[model samples]
Target: MFIRTENFSQYVRAYPIVTFLLALNIGIFILTWIPGIGNQLLLFGIGDNFLIANGEYWRLVTPMFLHGGLTHLLFNMFSLFIFGPELEKIAGKARFITIYMLAGLFGDVATYFLQSGDYRHLGASGAIFGVFGAFGALVYYTKHVFPQLKQVILPIIVISVVMTFVGTNINVTAHIAGLITGFLIGLSYFNPKNIVSWRKKR
Candidate 1:
């Protein structure tokens, strides 16, 4: 892990959105280790759970910080570790973070609206998919912009999407919502005029 960190820092800004996101995720995970903290956090997840019974409407976001188990948490974090830096490089820190959190938020919203009662869900899969979708848009857009990068980047998008879909125990709805959300964000942000506007604002 330390070697990976050293390598990551050598190439990109260590304190970028990726790092912040990872920290937020791991920090929240640690907090969940506290006896009542995890249960309390679980209340806000998308499901027919205690949070739902208690009317904790804010759990949509809160649940995102909690995971069902270690395997679930690790998978999400691994995806973030793998795809995050690349996506951050393309979208930059602020936009990347915005897309990630919004995508997760959107995922939970979709979950809440689509599902029936008595089921709850949580994880950062939504945000991970968002990152993946954004990276896909980068490829789609870059083929026209940089053209040469397609050889490498296009495959990354395909494999990532496939992994998201094929993986077990994934919340497909959240992934789909996140993917669509990310694609839209990428398209809007990369639009010629919007890019100019975005650049100017930044």
Candidate 2:
């Protein structure tokens, strides 16, 4: 019964955070094809986000919704589709959304601090990478318990991080920095003790 509840994925399946984020990213990406509308959209952007232009301080948050191109959106959403359900299950709906948005926000901040002078960047990779790092916590103490998961999940994160760097046409600094921040968040806040829920074995 406990296993059933733990793995049911109810919150993620019906939650607004998941739908809202996906819709926002896809909507913005579609708008990018509209010629002048794309330019105006980004005229208020900040950092490397599309639609971030002209000191739109809000772009710090909005950039998470923008992507560099179709491939970028696909890759980020795929990562979300894969791992986010687990995170939402782990933290519940409210906490899950907080972490997702927070991670993206932190990723944006990292970009701003590291880069300067209107250097632009965009994508959900930073946020998804946060989820990637958060899952690292699951592997830390459960390696023996779930050897299969340990084997699969860690490599995904490592390979993703590596690919962000070793691959061509990527923002290595933002990717790496976002990963580092994400991992730290997972390590610091993820508590294995929380998983041991009990309702009186008797």
Candidate 3:
């Protein structure tokens, strides 16, 4: 079942970090729409190998907050809204922040090394895929407790991989990099043994 927010105030109280992220992305999207601002936003997006090699290292972090278009922004934000809150709650504020950022950075690194040409990249897909990877890891670690999740997780992973190949202009390497980074982080942090104890305490 999907996690649905009842109201704006209640949603903010439940998922402050997710709320802030959503707001920030939306705010940036609005800004980019303003006259003469789209070009400014492009300056912050991830450039090709030469620009990054020239010491524009900040591109790794900034691209995660930029988007190529309204559809790009909407899809990534929707994914974040859906998967972010539960992972944030499970991972806690600091750890969740770490996973989100590291995944995006790793994705950028992958793109920098693997991708060629003068193409620019932007969007939060890398971090969003990180959330998916984290969820997959949790389902894997807790398979005994939640056996049905495997059935759901495998298909999603497969479809994502397939889509990555089929879709034009897709950053398949970034998605894979983020997924692997997130999976390792999740495997290390989310202990299945602690789940029982946490549940009992609750």
Candidate 4:
């Protein structure tokens, strides 16, 4: 299910939400590199608990589109590109974006609540973890129809959780919170109709 064989046009045509998200993320990351305003952009876009406390509530959503560096941008975007399309396909455009935004937002909110006021973070890791969590839900509900999904997606979920702790400066709170939020959302938001519809299309 994870293998991507589509060419650029086909991929874009089939997965508009993923395509738009990839473009939006890459575009914002590029904007943050513009010489004079780069640092300023990072300052404003990053999720700073202190700023959020001061009523800059947008920080929760903004950080999902911001990245600390090229590697950070690439990693998150790559994760989205690989895993996002399938979910978007199954969930449809509206539900897909809702899952992503909710997952990312809950992660940032968790960080705001759990971290020091001075804590700051930028990346889509929380949202990406949410995507994985949704995948876990999908596997659980569809195991009878697609038994191999457990074997495929479960290892990814486990490895991702382990890697979250292994990395430095990682926001463990955001990742965990986003993951739980996503799983719960997935369980309630996605019905058998959506899954069966996706299967029919495939």
Using TM-score, give the best candidate's number.
4
Count of clashing residue pairs in every prediction? 4, 8, 0, 0
Reference-based lDDT, residue 183, model 4: 87
Better of 1 and 4 by lDDT: 4
Each prediction's whole-model lDDT (CA): 0.71, 0.68, 0.80, 0.88
TM-score: model 3 vs. ground truth: 0.91
Model 3, C-alpha of 135: deviation from truth (Å): 1.0
lDDT of 1 at 153: 55
- Model 3: how large is the Cα RMSD against the reference? 2.0
Candidate 2 local Cα displacement, residue 182, angstroms:
2.4
> On a 0 to 100 scale, what is the lDDT of residue 97 in model 2?
73
- On lDDT, the stronger of 1 and 2 is 1
Q: Tens digits of per-residue lDDT for model 1 on 1-202?
A: 1124446566446536777778888988887788997667565343554455467778677656677888888988887877777566556678888889889888888887776555578888887888777766766665675555567656666776787679876677888898888878887666565434433542
Q: Give the alpha carbon lDDT tens digit for every residue of 1-202 in model 2.
A: 1122333366445445766677788888888779999877755442553334345568677777777778888988867766776666665677667667777778787777676655777677777877777777666756776576678888888788778867886666566666666667667666655544311210
Candidate numbers, best lDDT first, in rank order: 4, 3, 1, 2
How would you encode candidate 4's per-residue C-alpha lDDT over 75-156 as one tens digit per residue? 8888899999988888788887888889999999999999998999988888888888888898889989978878988998
Q: Could you say which candidate leads in lDDT?
A: 4
